[model samples]
Target: MSNPAQPDHYSGLLQGIGQRLHSARQQAAQTVNTLLVQTYWHIGQHIVEFEQGGNEKADYGSGLLDRLSKDLTALHGKGFSRSNVFYMRKLYLSFQNSETLSHKLSWSHYFEILKADDPLEISFYTRQAALENWSVRELKRQMKSLLFHRLALSKDKQGVLQLASQGHELQQPEDLLKEPFVLEFLNIPQSHVLTETQLEQKLIDHLQQFILELGKGFAFIARQYRMSIGGKHFYADLLFYHRILKCFVVIDLKRGAIDHQDIGQMNLYLNYFAKEENVEGDNQPVGIILGAYKDHFLVEYATASITNNILLAKYLLYLPDKDVLRRQLEKLLLAEQWDEPLAESDSNE
Candidate 1:
């Protein structure tokens, strides 16, 4: 009779073989994608050179792309539309160095990146998309949300450049914070009077998108995470573990402007988590008091004495105006007024 362990050993061998096959197939797909992207880049180069050989501006207006689309579609079929050809040309112009292209991103990702109006915006989205492993849909959403503008609003010129070059880096607690965190995905109208419970429920119902808004390294732990002390109960609105920071993040949602009491409660939650829930090797817990509005002076004074990793931010039900945010960022960079607070009124109710 066959040994009883033979089946187990055979199963392990099969598992290993399956994993290898999966890895090889992924590699093959990635290689194919990279080759196609490079091919399109070369095609763009050819188009540019052909245009240069004639009157450049004249050829552009003379429907070069329109004629090229018909010929290329007839020969190759599909994916050679005038708009796509225009994008391919733009792709080459945007990224002259083929080596700079990330293998992690597909042509679809680059197509979205090329739509950006500014070079810095393009670079920022490109780096962020690759590093965050964002899908085409996610990339589009982030672009619409004006994520680059949100992050750059507090940074100086050099800091803004760093964002474009390196994407959003999560080195410390503050790095993970964004003011007026966009909640458009919740489908909640701003005019509707929202309760804390309703807001929390909506966030839980759309946890995936919420985490995406939360940025990288956040893993949802619980909603209404409970803390019991002296037989009294306290519940955090949402609790997430940050893999990068090695800490628990407590989020407290407020329907309106946050008060001193809200800050103190969040502080209490941080202290309790640090002393009670945090295991060995875990860093200090972080607390974020998210609300519709904030009293800037109150926030500054209330948290002045508190020595904890706490962040206060606003949440909006609608997408922020890109022009307004962009203008604000420009002023911030030029002034290098890091201490100057951004106007919280930009979030439309």
Candidate 2:
């Protein structure tokens, strides 16, 4: 026993015991969750096997799940609604191998993913959820935002397949780009007039969600990052250092379409960062001009001459129409068959 009057000894003992208790509680909760997930998977497997056994009496209709749900709730008290039992059946169908199921994801995560009809989309969400440890809420948000389609739109067929298989990989500067970056989380109405400053402030206010939308490897560095050139001052709208890319990413926000001057300014910022700000062993900085819209022809011609790793992208105030995006993605996938193979063969030649 320690004297209460001796604050140091008492505090140390209290903290040590508190930490141990917290850790133990976490371990216990994780064990219970893991067991629950495994048990649900087994139940799904059993249901599927029983259905396949040619039991016409049980296959009398969709009544099987309803009856099962009632019996389970009557016995176990909760957590087995008709919908939940249906998802369990889907869980067995979607991922037949119990060993392939992720222990990290809860049943809620699987439920959200199982709702997706596309196998590729399901696989992408599954891999991304497990890799990023996304909460059920986060998973729902991403699914609604059509994160897979957004990332896949820029990729060729092979790239799309890789995304479905490996999840988002931040290997280079281009890997970090997402066109029409969804900022619906900012909650600003598109009809409302917005200034560059107001948008920046709202982004800072929702910094956590903004960082999530920015994807992995981004670490916030500064806002309105100042730079000097020839006794004149310029401020970048947002500055981020990508931990994985090992470079600074300067973003300039535009309330409207990006102009030629915007391109020139971002190039200047990248040049300054590469020469003055970047320390040894740091890679060349990347610049992004994020605006409401841009003319593709104008951007292509403007950036074609400049050598800096500058990217131009749009930001939407509301969630994009997923159906429209899916159609566009389908077009890209279809075009890849005729385009990518030719390009690859040319490169080899």
Candidate 3:
């Protein structure tokens, strides 16, 4: 006998049990995080109170915390060490006011930020981490290399504030550029040499990670898309539709450094898509040249006079060392800042 009804009944019961378990797990995690955040808030409040109460007697606060930590550890168990109490004091000092506190960020996130001495940079990274929901590892990497400072150097005071308050918004073309796109998801070593086909295949296989690396609003359209015109044929490396930009993005991958010819090719592709392939409501197509390396001087000259929708950018197969990339971005920004003056000087000569 098949016993069809019995199997269906059991499967339904199991599914209900699984759903209940998932709900319980989620509730438990939420409760734990809430309690932890509440405790940190109280800790901050107490520290402020102690300091305001004129406890200026030499090292009185320190002695009090040392004794309290021992008693709390004995009573409650681990996680109340003296060093952690110091972190609580620093955390309170870092965020002096409650208005700036975020309910979404966890205590662990603040603890990590408290390790940094720079208050401005700490605040910047904290807000960014909360808004982006970055993992602890991502926070560590960004903070260690001073990602905020690098970006701030590229913009004026107002622009810096905008970047901190609201992250990279892709309303315009320049906003889509990040000097180095972190590709740790690829799991490839920085030193490893890979062919263009190999890189393309890896990106396709791990398409989800690739989308994240490309930043927000990128949705994959096709890979190795074919195109034919009159007597010639060409294949685009990858095609993506950016939801926010409301445009088709065509990407061409080059294994080596980019040249002027590459820019011309991408421009041709953009023109074809803009004139022939775009749907009724679609915006003009944008083409990007993704090469392993690029000469910014040559690229600027190559793309400067052109009005078509095309951008040239470098892509890395692996996550670059943060310090090196930070230096590179800083140099690039400085050069861009002096470009107008340099051009004028050259014209006068």
Candidate 4:
């Protein structure tokens, strides 16, 4: 005769204690992290104050940092090396106001955010990293991918500014798409030939990285989503659900330059998805045709008739040549006479 209720009571008590301990540890860690960040900010402020307005170098600035680093290392152990001290000073200059400091982020986050030279770019990364709960490594990955710069290129100056002030806004299809979508993480080379099937497989294999490249809120649905109409079967290359938009995204891959046929096929897929797959409370399906190259003029004409959110975009095997991409975007901006911002998905067919 054992007491079943007593065992249950003890188990519940243990669980409660464990939960309390875990919460306390988390709170303590956050407190320590916040204090450390503030300390580094103050250290940076002091170092900058020693330098002239934190920009012009004083005569003894180089040696001063070295001496301070050595002294700090002796007092506080290995974390205070010359580079670390330099970064602490940088952290101070980057976020000058105490009010701007974040308790949620550790100093490691600041170390990565400080790499951005542009102030607005820094702000955008900071906002996104916090909003997305991104680790330092994710922050580094995004910076290397030139996420902020690519997104900024697609917006007017005001929109770009808003991105810095507020994180990404996902009200429309264009809000979530990035043009000339970077697939460099797939490890495919420019010289390496990629077929549609092969590209689709690589994207699945590197699904996490691909989702990051695709922007946020995309959940993979099927690789070759099959739909039939009038006893004829057609396979979509890839299908995804965007959590934010609450709609399906169908992507068709092409190895060669884009043609009208590819766009027409994507539109057909969108129509099928809308009719068959959509349920109550779902938005209209959006289609994207991804190809190696697309003629801008042809894409413009092809997309003129469609009211639905069908878009065409170029896919890069390797990371884009940033210089060339910048030039092309600028050309697009000038061509439009700043009247309408070019939507990332509003290209190709």
Candidate 5:
């Protein structure tokens, strides 16, 4: 073989050079992206101005984009298509006088949202996407599934605005509970024979997407976390720490319907963590039982006796039909409203 020292020296030099080239490429990409965003912003501004006051003597402003697009494509390149020019105009109108426009949102993200017909909805998703630091793919998925509409249906108007504007706040116990947790990250089909072990492994493999699906502020703590009390040993499927809530979130995955015993078992896990394993400043451990199906009545009855912080929610392997979920949410809201009057009348006695 050749000299070992020579190989080591050459490898070190190659690594250094590779790192420098990577850094340079990243910087060049950032520079090019910034210039492109700025150019689009300026183009949008110019289009708006042209429409407002291009020439007072002649009606040249009406189809200026069409004529300009034709000439620019012929002379310059294909980037100045008529459709793209119209998007520029819409972009200016959409974000006029707003100071938040910046590199926080990429041009691709803006273009994706601009395809929406509703300006209000577009603005809402755009602001949310920027605040959440979502990729273009994530934005498209949210839009396709009508995440805003689902949240609006589930929460009150103020709550909806709060979630969209301030991001998810885990202040209250109820805030941690999402009716149907989105699991589009898991590529496994719903019909697949997926075991709990397989599901947990998949989640760990795609942990980043899992964290996103779990919402903000969640950091993975452990998987297959083991706990033993007395002669019995128990294991949690997944455990997370919510930074914002300052608590340990314990999740148990169940492939079938939830039972009363599952709630008790989860309570046991929570008690073990709270009394034994939790740090001095950590909040009481919260337990969530994610099952394929749950009987709402059984869940309420089982959880009612336990005073500890625990919740039972359903999980899906794929995105549920939005129309069906929306109707169900509406029905729940109507039932709550109908029950309120009866509850008030009963209390008055």
Candidate 6:
């Protein structure tokens, strides 16, 4: 065989060249994206300015958008359609703070975030999209899945405002939980009977989407984490390490209605983790039970005395009813006495 040094040198050279080229291309792309977003901002600023002038041109300035779309499409050939122009105008209005804008995200990212009715939400999603480096498609998926509302189930109005300002920080036990995770991406039909093994396998197969749904900083550790207590053996369903929480997160899935047994089992798992698995510097582990039907009373009673961080939340195989869920989530947050000094859990995924 040839000298190993020759191959090693060539491999190193190849990697170095590849890295430099990739970085250069990324820089060029960022430059182009920054310019494009700035251009759209200017276009939107001009449109808003024109609209505010009260020119009395026509009903709702409808003709202005049509005329602009036609002329700009003729000039730019792409990205200046009537709908796009409207989005541009919205982007300007939604975030008047130039400080909130990022060169990392494209105009498309802003377009999707504008769908949020709340200004704080728009700001939150924009920051999160940039911070997460989420693609346009991923950003849209999170927004459509109602990630904000899911998190909102635990946070009050001030907490909601904090979420907008800081994004979801996984500090508290409540912060670790996101209610009613939407798993529509798994392609499991509502009619399809899914076993625990099948559900775990599906989540593994779609790990990327699963992690995104789990929110920030959750890194999958083991599928069925094993722990033996005395002569008996137990396996936690799915285990993850939350980098932000600096603690282990255990998930137990239930296909049917969850009762006291589910909570007890999860509590056992959490105790095992805190006692056996936890090393120095790590915080107490948290457990979550995602069942088809959640009995809040059962969960509250089961977890009342147990100090281990645990939550019982509902899960839907199919997409959730956004309006109904939004109202329900709002009610949950509003009902809570959230006046305590709130500390959102910090995480990065």
Each candidate's number of clashing pairs is: 0, 0, 0, 0, 0, 6
In model 1, which residue pairs have backbone atoms overlapping below 3 Å? none
The worst-scoring run of ten residues by lDDT in candidate 5 lies at 340-349
**Tens-place lDDT digits, model 2, residues 1-349:** 7555778878888999999999999888778777887888888888988878975223313889879989999999899988888888788778878888887888888889999988899889999999989999999999999999889876789999999988888888888777569999988887998999999999999999999998888899999888888999999999999988999999899999999899999999999999999998899999989999888778889999899999888889999998778777776776687673333332111
lDDT of 4 by residue, 1-349 (tens): 7766787789999999999999999999989989999999998888888776655442234787788888998998887877778778878777879778777788888888887767887888888888887888888888777777677666766677788888777888877656668888888867889778889999999989888888778899998989998899999988899998999999889989999888888888888888899999999998888888888778889888987788777777666566655555455556467666555553322
For model 5, how does the per-residue alpha-carbon lDDT over 229-283 read when each residue is reduced to its tens digit?
Answer: 8988789999998888888899998888888999999999999999888898898
17-39: candidate 3 lDDT, tens digit per residue: 99999999977886787578667
Candidate closer to the true structure by lDDT (higher is better), 2 or 5: 2
TM-score for predicted model 5 compared with the true structure:
0.74
Q: For model 5, what is the error of residue 144's alpha carbon versus the real structure, in angstroms, after optimal superposition? A: 4.1
List model 6 lDDT by residue over 1-349, tens digit each.
6666787789999999999999999999899988888888878788878878985232224888888889999987988877788778887787676556788898888888887887767878888888788999999988887877777766677788888888876667788666788889999878899998999899899998889888888899989888999889899889999988889999998888998988888888988888898999999998989888876557768889998888877788877678875666555554455534323221100
Off by over 4 Å in 1: 1-17, 58-62, 337-349
Rank list by TM-score: 2, 1, 6, 4, 3, 5
What's model 2's lDDT at 245?
90
Question: Which candidate would rank higher by TM-score, 3 or 4?
Answer: 4
Candidate 5: stretches off by over 4 Å: 1-35, 45-69, 117-121, 142-146, 149-154, 169-173, 325-349
For candidate 2, what's the RMSD? 4.3
Q: Give the C-alpha lDDT of model 5.
A: 0.75
Stretches of candidate 6 exceeding 4 Å from the true structure: 1-7, 56-61, 329-349
lDDT comparison, 1 vs 4, better candidate: 1
Local distance difference test scores for all models: 0.87, 0.86, 0.72, 0.80, 0.75, 0.81
Question: Which run of 10 residues does model 6 get worst, by summed lDDT?
Answer: 340-349
Task: Report how far residue 17 has shifted in candidate 4, in Å.
Answer: 4.1
